[model samples]
Target: MKTGNQDSSAVKAPDAARAAGTDYERIFHPRRVAVAGVSPGGGVGFGTRYLTSLQAIGFEGEILPVNPKGGEIAGLSIFKNVEDIPGELDLIVIAVAAEAVLPILEAGRKKGAAGAVIITSGFRELGTSEGIGREDEVRRIAASGIRVIGPNCFGIYCPKSGLTFFPNPDLSRESGPVAFLSQSGGLASDFMMTGMWMGLRFSKVVSFGNGADLREAELLRYLADDPETGVIAMYVEGVRDGSEFLDALKAAAAKKPVVILKGGLSSAGGRAVVSHTASLGGSRVIWESVLRQAGAVQVRDLQEMAQACLAFSLLPERVYRGLSFTGGGGALGIAACDAAETFGLEVPPLGTDARGRVEALLPKSGASGVNPVDVANPYAPPALLEKIFRAVAGDSRIDLQILIVLTHHFKGLAQDQGKTIEEVFPYRELADRMKAVAVETDKPVVFVLPNAKRGFPDMDVVEIHAKVREAFLERGLPVFDEIGDAMRAIGHVNRCYGKGETS
Candidate 1:
C-alpha cells in the first residue's frame, strides 16, 4: 500500500516549514476531501464507514476515495495513489494500517491539504517502541504543513460542513452554539447522541484520539475565539501539557462558559486512562484546584455536563440569585427551597402585594401564596399557571422562576374522559403560555416535568412526558426531570457569572 510520491524530499522538514497558522475554516468546512484506505468490497472499515457517513449527512463536498486496489466505493473511482488526485485537497481522512499512515499523511501534506483526521490505531496507546515511533512520525509530518486531529480516534463532526464521525449518520445537521472536545471517541459519539434530545446543539464536535498533533489545549484556544461557539464542553481523560492546558482553560473560561468533565480521577480509573489514551491522569486535588482557579465549571458526569451546557446555552449571562418556585404540592415546594438553599440560591417570600395577588389566583383551600406557591391541585389549567407565573415574576427580588408541572397526573383525567394522555393534557398550550409569561415578564422561566411512573405499564405516560419535554424545549425553556437537577444547573450558571456570593 504505497503511494506514488515516495520521495521523502518532496516535503520540507517539520521545523523549517511548520504551518504559520492553522486554517480552521478550511479544515472545518472543506470543499474537497479524500478518504484513504477504503476497500471497494465494502467491508466495515473505518474509511468506508466515514465516507458513507459523510454521504448520509449530505456532505456537499467532492469526496475522493483512494485504494491501492484501484476499485470503486459509493460510485466514486478509487485513486490508486494520493499523488494521482487532481489539484489541492482541503482535507484527508486517513484510515489505513499503522505502517502506511506516515506515507499517506506525508503525501497529503505534499498535496497541500489543510488537515487530516487519522482514524487508524496502533499508535502510542499500544505502549510499544514501534507504536510510539509511528506516532512521532505522524506528529513530524503534521508539523511540516498539514494539521492532524487523531492517529487512533474517531474524526471530526462539524454540522455546518456535514462532516460526521464514524457510525453516526443520523446526527443532527442543525448547527448550534455549543462546541465539545473529547479525547475518547466513544464518549464524543455518545455525547452527540445525548445532545440530540437534551436540546444541546453543537457547532463542532471533535474526537481527537491519541492527540499526537492537535490536542485539548490548542482546540480550547481555538474554540474560545470561535464566533460560532458560545458554550464549550470538554471530556478529558488526560491532557498532553498541564501548564498549557491550564492557561488555555483560564483564557477560554474568561471568554465563555467552559464546562469540563474530567475522567480518570480515581485510582482505578487512572490506570484505565493510561491504557485508553496513553496519557497521564493528573492528581485529583490538583485538578480540582486548577479547575476552580481557572473559573471553569467542573461537572461529575456526562449527564451533569449536558445539563450545565443546556443551562448555559439557554439562560441569560447573569447571576440568578433569587428564584420563585411554583408547584402542585407543598412537599415539592419545600424540596425546591431546600435544593435552592443548598446551591447558594434564595427562594425568598413574596412581597405583601405580590403574595396577595398570587394567593387570590390559587385555590381557596390547601393553597399557599408564599415563596414556593403550591396550587394543591395537579390538574391546574395552563391559563391559571400562566397567571401564577406572571404574578411570581412581578416580584422584585426574584431573578428567575421555576414552575413544576406534574404532567403524569393528567393520565387520570385522560382515563376519566376516555381519551389519551396526549389529548387530555394541554402541554402545547401550557408551553406556549409559559413562554409568553417569560417573554412578558422579562425573566427566564424553567420548567420541571417530573414523572414518578415510568414502568412498562405506563408507556403512555412516558411518551407524553417525552412529548411535553420536547414542547418545552422547543419554546427555549429548559426542562429537567427533577427539581434538584434544575437547581444544580442554575447553580452552575450563577457560579460562572456571579461574584463570590454564589461560589
Candidate 2:
C-alpha cells in the first residue's frame, strides 16, 4: 500500500541524514520557524511553552503561530494554516494532535519546510493499533523529503541561535564545548540544567524522543562532525540499530570524548523503557562490551556523566598518577588514600626533601608530613600552606594535588579554638596561594570543600562556603564536595586520555 517515494525514503532515511548539505545546522539553526496549535490565551501546554521559550531565549526569527481558531498571541497575529503564512518557512513545529499532524506536515512540505519538530504525542508509545497506524502515517510523511525531529520530544535547544525548548532554563546563553543528546525529554532538561550548576556549559542539546526519523546514530554522527562541540554527552535507553550505532559511536569517539549513560540495563528498567520511548532495550553485557570496544566512557547515572563531561571539558589530556591533599585530620588523609587507591591512582609518599620542607611549615604537634599531607587544620597561615603545597607540587612523583578546605564546619572549629574566622579561614590568601602553586607546577590542582551548604538556616556558613568555592572555581580550579567524586572524575579522565595516547 506504500507509495514508491515513501518506500525509497524509508530505505535511505538513515543515509540521507548523513548526506551532504543536510546536517544538524539546518535543523537546529533554522532562520524562521512556525508553531502550530498555539492557543491565543497563553495557557499551560506544549504549544505555549515552545512559543514563550523562543521569545525568552531571544530567537531572532519570524515566529508564525498557526491555529484554526486563532486571532493573536502576545500581540502577534496567528495564521490559520501554514499555507496562509507569507514567504518561505524554514522550520515548522507541529504541536497539534496525532490525527492532525499528517495534514500539517503536508502543508509544511508544500510550503518548502526545511525541517519539522513534531511535539504531539499519542503515537506508537500508546501501545494500541490505532497509535501504531498513526506512527506509520508520521513515518510516511517524514519520508517525503522533510526531516522530522520527534513525535514526542522537547526538540532542539541551541543557545548560540537563541533557540530553547523550556522557559527559565537557568543557564547562560554562552555556549561551551559539550553537546548532549537524550531520548527522554524530562531527563535531558534535568541534566542540562544540573550540568550548568556544576559549571558545565553546552554547545547544543537535543531531546529527540522515539527518534522515529532522526535516531541516535544519526545524531552521534552529526555531533562528531560538529565544530562547536568538543565533547559529547549522551543518555540513551535503546538504539534501533546496534551495529550502525556502534559504528557511529566509534567514529565520534575518535574525534572527541564520548560519555554515555545507558539506561534499561535491567529487566524492570527495560520494560519501563519500552513504555517510555517504545525502544528495544539491549542486554547489559552486550552494551558494556560495545562501549568498551567503541572507546566511549560509560557512566552509571546522569550525575556521573555530568562529572565525566566536566573533566573532559576542563582538563587537558594528561595522565594523573600521584595524589596529594592538604587539610582535614589524619582520618581524612586515610580516606583520601583509600579513594585514590580504589580508583587505581597512586598515593606515593612525599620525598625526604619535600617532607622536610612541609615539616618546617606545619606545627610539630598536629600534622602528617607523609602523602595526603594533612596540615591538621585548613586555617593554617597562607604562606606556610603555600610552602607545603609548592613543595608537594614541586616533587616529581606527584601529578595532581587536592587542597581540602573544610568550609562550613571550619568556622565553628576556629571559634572553639578562641580564634576569629578570618584568622582561621583566610579564604582569599589561601586561594591566592593555591593559584600561585597551580601556575608554578605542571600538574593539575583542584579544591575539595566537603562541608558546602546552601539555603540553610545557617546563612552565615552558606555564604562563607559559597565565597570560598567561588574563589577556587574562578581560578579555573574544579571544586568537589567529596573526595570520591574528585578522584573518580580524575581516574576516568586519566584512563580516557591514557587510551588516546596508546590509540
Candidate 3:
C-alpha cells in the first residue's frame, strides 16, 4: 500500500532497517517452506496444487501444510496453525480465505519466517471497502516485519531451488541468467511456459499480484545486484510509486539488460488493469518515454518480451550493427532486408572477394550471393549452406548473420524419398555446421525456421521443424519462427547496447 504520495520519512526506522537487511537468499532458496490452507481431502485448491507442484519440481526442502481441520496431504502431516509449526519457517505460502490471511501472516512473521506469498484473492482488486480494508490490514502486518510477495498471485519460481508457481509443474529446472517480474500471475505462468520451448531459461520469476508489500521497485533493486541474473524482464501494469520505480529501473538497467512489457497502455487495457490489480495504468506515451529514459527495452507483448529475453540471454552483450542474411527464395531475402532495416539493422553486401566465393559455391541457376544469400533451393545441403554462411560471414563489416531455413518445404523431398521430413532434412548436421561456422567466423548466426504449413496434413513437417529448432537451440543458436521476430529481438539488443544506453 506504499503510494507515490507517501513521504519518504514516513517509513518506521526499524522497518526500513529490516527491509535493508532482507535475507533475499533465504527468501529465494528457502530450506523449509510452509503452505497454509491445504485441503486434507486432496482437492485441487491453490495450496494443494502448490504443494504438489513443489514436489513435482523435486523441491529438496521440507514442506509443511497447514489447515485448521487438517489430517494429511501427500503423506505429509498438516499443521493446524502457523504457531503450531515446530521451528522457524524460511517461507510461507498463504492460500486461505481473505478473512483468514492476516492471522496466518502474523503467525508466520512471529515464527521468524523470511518471507510470505499470499495466494488468496479478495483484496483491493475487488474495488470494495471491505476488500480495501482487508488489503490494508495485510500491508500493515507486512510492514511490521515479513516481506510479502502477493495477496492474489501465483507466487515465485526459482529454477535453482526447484520452487515453482502453483500451476506450473513442468517449468524448466535448468537455471539461466534471466529474471522476470510480473503483476499478473497468468502472464507470468504463460511466459514461463513459452520460455521453455523458446529456449529461455530463467533464474527467477515472481508474479507479485496486487503487490501488497514487496513489488516492482524493491524487487528490481534486488535483482539488479543478483549475481545469478544477467537479464531482467518484467510485465508491469502499473507501479505504486512512479519516482521510486523509475529510479530502481534506471539502476537495474545500468547493471544489466531490463526488458519491459508494459500492459494496459491502451484505454480499454488500462481499465482492465485497474480492475485486475487495482493499479493505475498510465498513458502509453508516458510509459514509453519513461522506459526509454530509464534505458530499458520496451516490448509490446509476451511473445516479443520472450524473444527479447532470449536474445539478451544467448547473444553477446555487444551491439550488432551489420548483418548477413541467408535464406532461400527471393521474397524471403527481401523480407529479411526490410525487417532488418525496420529494426535499425543493415544487411550490408559482402565484399567483392567474399561474394565471389559464395556465388561460386551456390547453384548457378537461381542463386544470389550479394547480402541475403539466396540459395534458391529450400533443400540446400548443409555443406553448401555452411560454405555460403562462411563466405558471407567473412565480410569484415558483418557483425552477425541470420540463416532462414524453409524446413517445411522438405516435406516434398520427404514424400519423394518415401521418408519422414526429419529423416530427409539433415537438421542435426546443419545445426552442427552452423555452430562450427559461427565459432570459426566469430559472428553469431541466428536461425529462422519458418513453418508456413501447420495444418493437420502438415503435422509431420511441423514436428520436424520443432526438432530442427531444438537442435539449433541446443547448439546455442537462437531460433525464431519469422524473420521479423528475429530482427526485432536483435533490434532490442542493438538499442540497449548500440546506443550506449543503460541496458
Tens digits of lDDT, candidate 2, 1-503: 23323444355465645444454565788787899989887776677778877876778878899999879886679998889998877889988978999899879877778788888888888989998898887778777777788888888788888778654444567788899998888899889877876768788898888787777887898899999999999998988866668878999998898999998886332444535334543467668878979989899997788888877887777888788887757888888889988888888999999888888877878788888787877556778877888888878889888888777776687679997555567788788878878877867678877875555666767767777877776676777778888889888887777884652
The alpha-carbon RMSD values of the candidates against the true structure, listed in the order shown, are 6.9, 5.6, 4.4
TM-score on alpha carbons, each prediction: 0.92, 0.87, 0.93
TM-score-superior candidate, 1 or 2: 1
Clashing pairs in model 2, backbone N/Cα/C closer than 3 A: none
Positional deviation of 132 in candidate 1, in angstroms? 0.4
What value does the lDDT take at residue 410 in candidate 2?
66
For model 1, name the residue pairs that clash. none
Q: How displaced is residue 241 in candidate 1, in Å? A: 1.5
lDDT of 3 by residue, 1-503 (tens): 34556765453344446668888888999999999989999899889999999999999999999999979999999998889999899999999988999999999999899899999999999999999999999889987888999989999999999989978888888999889999999989989889889999999999999999989988998999999999999999889878778878998999899999998776433444535344544476668988989989999998999999999988988889899888889899998999999988998888999999999998888889998888888888899899888888878899999999898888898889999887888889999999999898889999998888999988888788888999999999999999999999999999888765543
Model 1 per-residue lDDT tens digits across residues 1-503: 14234443343233113433788888889999999999899888888888998999999999999999988899899999999999999999999998999999999999889999999999999999999999999988887788999988898999999998877998888998899999899999999888778888899999999999888888888899999999999998887656667877888999999999999886332434534333443477668878889999999998889999999989989999889998889999999999999988999999998899999999899999998999999888999989888888888999999999898899898999999998888889999998998888889999998899899999999999999999999999998888899999999999998846625
Per-candidate local distance difference test: 0.89, 0.80, 0.89
Return the clash pairs for model 3, or none.
none
Shift in Å, residue 154, candidate 3: 0.6
Which candidate's lDDT is highest?
3
